[model samples]
Target: MALHLYALAILMGAIMSIYIPMISQSARVMGAAVMGNVPFFFVAFVTSVVIALVSGQRGDSFRKIADVPPWLFLAGVMSAGIILGATFLVPRIGTGALFVLLVTGQILAGLAINQFGLLGVPAQPMTLSIAAGAVLVIAGAALVTFGAVT
Candidate 1:
């Protein structure tokens, strides 16, 4: 059941990877009309609040913020950068291209992160199969970026 749900979650993420940029492109236009050059921040602020409300209530009520390493705190900062970058780039490159590039980057970075155990995670040595899979993903991304999506 857990594995099924995880697969469903990945499917949902794939759907959102397409859907979100369309909404964000519209929001970017709205933000430009209402605010100035930094509409993505406004959109990000609202998104953060929604995410916090959904996530914050589910966990232990008395978690200690101070116990968390300061380095781990950068996740939110990184999320903001991703959101803002997507908002800026999706309109310029189109969603297919943007996500192809993004996924390619993610796979590459994930491979490195897993291999090195960077950011304090348990290191998993990169195997030949993993490298082959990563290469396949890159090739797929290249096709998605360059080929017609229809």
Candidate 2:
């Protein structure tokens, strides 16, 4: 439980830090996209490798990748697309608005994923409360995006 809380705190800090440098992140992601994902992925892969090596928990996960479903591998592609898209959108929409829309999309996608029990997760039935929460999120996104307009 303590480790979970620590991880959650770190995640929250990371999220906050990302918004502070969103423009730089966007530019870097765009540059990476243009230059080819190999360099970008290589850097991130090496960083992960170093971290794993230092942590002393370097399991044989890579060796077992072939055993996992092929669709699981698409996460890398999806991550690249998301990074590129966020890079393009953040400048146009502003970080706060972009984050609102992104969070809304994430919640909706999560709801669907949970509903269908995708990726080997247990099925989590979506109740009316969940639907209502999703609706509220969309409404909040709209307000964040358009509220300033006359």
Candidate 3:
């Protein structure tokens, strides 16, 4: 089941990778980027509220969120920062390069999360494949940056 789930995730990611820039940059053009992800998370949260209002999805599924201390609101602020960074980055670097950096960050972050097992996330046992993939992503980002410069 895990293998199949991973496969599906990879497939969907591959599909999205082809189109994410178009969507993000379009939003950026409309000044969504400058809003610091107010639109991004607002759209997501509003959709969830709409879905709940329509489908009557009950609470307790997000019981864990309520468990969080109030001070953690900073995460929401940081998410906006990240969204602005990505939104602006899309126009400056193009999607391919922007995503390469995103991938690089994700890889490093995943490693850190695995190392510390933070946020109730299970620690993943890393193999050589993970390291190789990180190295490849870094190389890819470097290539894109160099190509764009030259």
Candidate 4:
């Protein structure tokens, strides 16, 4: 079970590596598409609105303020944090470093997940080995990014 949990965490790290670069590439393409320095961020906002409107519909849907769930409002607030973080961080560090930071952040988040035993995920007690491993992994990332012997 411990090995399985570790594998999932590594897989998530790999996924973050791939997905973040892909998104940056897509954003660059979108930037190239507009030619007028049009903010690529509008793409996300536009899609978000369309998704909420379309997916919110049920077989016999009725859109009403009173029917709106508080959870949806909370989600919107969270989304704001996500978008703001992306805009600020992505431009500064570039996607590679940003995803590296994200993976490290995920290590902290995963520990919290383990501590609380959230979402039926198995709890793995944190240890020095895990902390040392995280430091080593982050160091390896730095070496790969900045090049060794530089």
TM-score against truth, every candidate? 0.71, 0.75, 0.71, 0.47
**Residue by residue across 2-118, what tens digits does model 4's lDDT show?**
999999988986875665455545556666422212343467668766887788755345346458867667766665455446545676676666766666676778878887787
Error of 3 at 31 (Å): 4.8
Better of 1 and 4 by TM-score: 1
> Which pairs of residues clash in candidate 3, taking residues 3 or more apart in a chain or in different chains?
none
Q: Weakest 10 consecutive residues, lDDT, candidate 1? A: 32-41
User: Model 4 residue 143 lDDT?
Assistant: 62
Name the candidate that leads on lDDT: 1
Instruction: Write model 3 residue lDDT over 8-91, tens digit each, in one string.
Output: 989986865754565576676676656545555768799888887678666665565788898788888876676667777777
Model 2, residue pairs in steric clash: none
The candidate that wins on TM-score is 2
For model 2, the run of ten residues with the poorest summed lDDT: 32-41
> Which of the two, 1 or 4, has more lDDT?
1
